[model samples]
Target: MQRIALLFLILGLNCIAAGAAEHSTACGSMQLAYYELGTLYYRHADGSYTGIDKDVVEEVAKRSGCKFDTVLESRVRIWTQLKNNTLDMSVSGIPTPEREKFAEFIPYFSTRNYILLHRDMPVHGLSMAGFLNDANLKVAVIKSFKHGPKFDEWLEKLWAQKRVYEASDIDSLLRLFLARRVDAIIALPTVWQPLLKKEEINKQVHLFDWAPQDSIVHGLIVSKERVSKARRDLLRKAIYSMADDGTLEQIFTRHMGSKLAQELRYDGPRF
Candidate 1:
């Protein structure tokens, strides 16, 4: 009986070792893309990156014991590369049908769409219909962003009437809005709040939530073509752990504040 028990213990230890090796081999190294979107990601003068997204990514890497080769890219290009499997991972991703076919999203935060208008713009009841009826109110949007279904519907209507301006990236969109080239821009409170820093600029901006009932979940995106099911499961577990342990809330609070952080804290079913 003693001999038999020893044999079982040795086998169990070997199985654990094998499992650890497999995990390491599966996610030992990966490619990650980052983009500038409000307080999510930004570059520093010393050629380093920081912000909520960066902090989250680093924490994930630490937990998973995976080394990430980070690259800077536009949101549009990030999606394209994710579809092509040329990228392994990216932050602040909201899944779509086409993207679901090529990537798996592990949600970490939640946000809703808001329309930031200049205070001097014509008062229009703060409704989509009011804004849509006013042909003079032109809005700018980032190229490949998903600002929720309602915003997309309004944007489509606006585009049909040539009342929309498209920007290549967030910085350009902010410039267009600040330069008075556009009447308003679609953004999340967490996104626009940090970008519009000047007190005078803040005074000129008025934010209205167009989709108060809708909350969009955003998080780490892993490419299906490049990542195996084993790795995806591992990553999902790591992200879920972060969400459960207050790590995610800590990161959000550090960058955006306790109130906004609590608002963004994701407490939904894991996908």
Candidate 2:
């Protein structure tokens, strides 16, 4: 496994010129749409993009001998564009059957744990069902996102009862929690901690380790229609190589922290 995951040469024009190749990844100089999902992807005032996702893409672009121009959009719009074959790729996408119908996921390199944060700590042993049972309580979650298998099931139950409040993104989720619109909101410490400080909401709420373990995984979600099978395969191999070389780990740990980087190690396949 270690040998297979080792850093491979980033493909360059010289490498291609050295030997004649047939199919191109179509990744050469393409436009990409990104979602403003915290540290994963950030947009700048000049309309340029930068962050962990950017780093990964740049690395891949360097290897693939491709250049990617990026634009920011809402998650829903990102999916819509992908379905319409207007977008190229995205980062930190948690795979689900519905998404796979339109896009293909590369080898996931990061693991994320979802926990419930509340205005105050609830009773010990409180479960997701406990929250669902109380009609008065509302849980805030990102729209069109799958929070692992267990929470996905629980969220379906909550949705059926109209007990869940869906938001467009994490910023909106934080707003919903701040306004006392939802009793609890699902969050990732790496994503929300900085927001809590910047927005000055740390003292206003408390976090709960509701997730049993850290298993949720994510990766670069590329559109199948826009990216060929060869390109996607190329990206998958590159991502796995990044993990093996600790480049992926360093990039994530630098922005998110070492503890989270360790917790969210590249654990092979996501089931």
Candidate 3:
């Protein structure tokens, strides 16, 4: 009878341990990817991710009790991995309709686009019209960037004239501009600021006073298959909570600087 009691006690302890392990693992592990950019996201010397997207997502995960891992990769690879189920989610400033088929966006941040040009480049009064009309001009744009169908049509027209160069990444395009290989590049101010600062090209590049075709709305994109509705809702709620509590603003301010925050007019659902 004592031997039988010991067996039952051992079984009970095993069950308790199993239950505790399951509880600890309830949130599961997820992988999120972001571009290796200065303002958006980047890997630290310690192999950790940091930037606006990282800060916001980490805060949401902390509040929601969701365990997550981050992958710092190229934007192209991130999208490819996300499609293949290697990445659970990503934060992208521009999400195209083609990408929407595989992922759902949790709307959060938005900003207007801008053009970056060499400060001493003589062309003034920069505009879409001016760029298209100048045969001597060369413009560099990134691959997979969603500038809408209208812009694509305009680019096709420009391409016929050998005016626009499609670059693999922003860094390459920026280098082209710095080397005087291209006349200008179109990108959001947020993206330009960090890279310009990094290359000490701030004094060399000038932001033209041209109006953007559209304002970009940034969001957290999750794989539809990987995240359940309950977890998705929980994460969204946590983001909203962070916004309400000013945590989002604090994070943005820490990385982006207060002056940039004000310039961007970032008065929205912050987190």
Candidate 4:
């Protein structure tokens, strides 16, 4: 009798453990890392956070039964966390050849580079090649953004003849542009648009033609260390399902304006 009761207790314990694992296996418990940039991500006046990336992630988590923990950090720090295995996932990251080695990607978002200039400045028909080749142009870009290094390398190859000032964040860069401290600032349209709207700087700056060379496909980046193949496959399926069912489009349109959301959808996959 005693042996039978002990066996039953052990079986019950095993069943409980198995049940817990299965219940918690949903993606809802995953922690997602993202940067605090204007439309991409930001803290609201009420202390709640909202952004296009956050909206999409939330919907994905809901559909996947994953709980998300969003960490607010700089773009570079977000990458560092993912590389170090501290973060499970991140969004709006532009994949470079160098980054592909460390992280697995799910392509979904589209991004473009815009040349932000003082509304009063007389500049038009700018090109990346022309900007880099010029000896007298001064450009301001956010430090640690994906384009920074590419721009730096290009400038160095030109013997660092042009000035490339690095601003700490988007707001500072926009302020510098408005103050006429730099000839131009470069950033994604999604990031630049919100800041311009918030600061009422739209009338103060003129957006030049898109920089196709610098534009990139943004995607969700998963840490290779923390997630198993099964989990990764699940994530990919969820993303594709969202894309097909128009969940992705709905989230994009809800957070970003309809016009911009339409553009993002048309930009094609960024791999």
Predicted structure with the largest lDDT when compared to the true one: 1
Q: lDDT of each prediction vs. the true structure? A: 0.85, 0.72, 0.73, 0.72
- The whole-model C-alpha lDDT of candidate 1 against the native structure comes to 0.85
After superposing candidate 4 on the true structure, give the runs of residues whose Cα lies further than 4 Å from its correct spot.
1-28, 123-134, 148-159, 212-215, 266-271
lDDT-superior candidate, 1 or 2? 1
How well does each candidate superpose onto the true structure, as a TM-score?
A: 0.88, 0.82, 0.79, 0.80
Query: Residue 259, candidate 3: how far off, in angstroms?
Result: 3.6
Cα lDDT of model 4 by residue, 9-28, tens digit: 99999999987677556544
Q: List ranges where model 3 is wrong by over 4 Å.
A: 1-25, 43-49, 147-156, 198-200, 262-271
Candidate 2 residue runs with Cα over 4 Å from true position: 1-27, 43-49, 121-126
lDDT of 2 by residue, 1-271 (tens): 6554443333455577555333243546667767777777776789776677778887877566556887778889887888888888877787788889998887546554465456464654156667766777778898887776677777788888888888988878888988888888776655665666664676776656666654566778888888888777777777877877888888878777887667667777632
Highest-TM-score candidate:
1
Number of backbone collisions per candidate, in order?
0, 0, 0, 5
TM-score of model 3 (CA atoms): 0.79
Q: What lDDT does candidate 4 reach at residue 115?
A: 73
Cα distance off (Å), candidate 4, residue 19: 11
Off by over 4 Å in 1: 1-26
